[model samples]
Target: MQTCKILQDISALQVLSINISRRCFYTTTTTSPLPWLFVGLGNPGEKYQGTRHNVGFDMIDVLAKSHGISMDRVHCKAIFGQGLISDVPVFLAKPQTYMNLSGESAGPLAAYYKLPLSRIVAFFDDMNLPCGVLRLQDKGGNGRHKGVRSLIHHFRGNSEFARLRIGIGRPPGQMDPKAFLLQKFNATARERIDVGLQEGVGALKLLASRGLTESARCFNKEQKYKHIRVQTLET
Candidate 1:
């Protein structure tokens, strides 16, 4: 899909050389707030659709719904909603390039906009946290995620961007991590995913408007749904 004309003034049009080549993706002719990019990491194609690893995409979908945003048909990209969060234009994207190569789509988009690494927020699934839990961090190591690793590589190992991680639970004993991520969410786990999705949506908005630290503080207290811990008397 082509970019909207509003985005042209931001250097994306020049980066793609649309004027000289006449080959443009989309054109938006509107003014907007400082452009911020949101990348939801996941594998491409129907086969991986709705899988646990696609929680990032799923969360973005929820965010769109909450804000009345719609996805526009862009070439090789699932993009939609050029609207305001705190009156700032935010671009939402789910890379069709699939996980592991997410940077292939996001890296260029970031460069084209001349956006600081700090302005990019990557939403993705995390196995370390318990199901229904959410965490927002400024930056960190990939922690065994190939997709994140690829993004880090494309950005030349800069982890200064914000990350919103949604827990997808861990694999059962002896199960392959890749296989598990590709698996659909179990019936019992659906509730947690729903709750996490809601929290993720809220966190995304807060992150976009307020900043990462504020969002992190708001979401860090969401562990109540994961499980309740109690003290016991020792004999």
Candidate 2:
């Protein structure tokens, strides 16, 4: 698994060098408030559903359901919906270029919408934390996540985009991370995972309305999801 991650990092660097011109022109004019782009990374296809790696897509579904955003339109190599979440206009995107090439979709979508990297959120699963936990950050490196690596690569190594990482926990001893990521959540962990997903949606909503500091406080403290209490939570 570690070897695979290293290879992915090398591959990303190579791709980043060639895709340096992914940035697009932007217009200064605007009538409405700037929109937010929430990107959920996952491989396309029903076979991938319910897998650890696809948790981002699962929560994106939760967000879209809560906001009444229909994600039927395809654009910029992703399926997305534009609508308001907590009265904040937002776009929820699921990239179809698979996991490692997420930026092939996300980068262009952000460019087309003229949304700055600061307002974009990358939601994905994290093995660094235990299940039933979450970590919301204003910005940071992707660690070893190739999907995020791809985004950073396309953004010219800029990790300024916000990220919401749902803790799926590391694979059990001696397991390959790739196999672990592709496995479906079993009954044993389902409850905790579901709870974490719910809390993640709340954290994401707060991020859209209340800003990163508060959202991080609500999501990323050492206590994690089990004990933290957040006020005025809606989205």
Best by lDDT: 2
- Give lDDT for model 2: 0.83
lDDT of 1 at 89: 66
Q: Which residue pairs overlap in candidate 2's backbone?
A: none
lDDT of 2 by residue, 37-149 (tens): 99999889989999999988888998898778899999999998888777678899999999999999999998787778988999998988676577788898888999999
TM-score of 2: 0.80
Runs of candidate 1 with Cα error greater than 4 angstroms are 1-33, 75-80, 224-235
lDDT of every predicted structure (CA atoms): 0.76, 0.83
* lDDT value, residue 198 of candidate 2: 83
Q: lDDT of candidate 1 vs native?
A: 0.76
| TM-score of every candidate relative to the true structure | 0.79, 0.80
Poorest 10 consecutive residues by lDDT, candidate 1: 226-235
Cα TM-score of candidate 1: 0.79
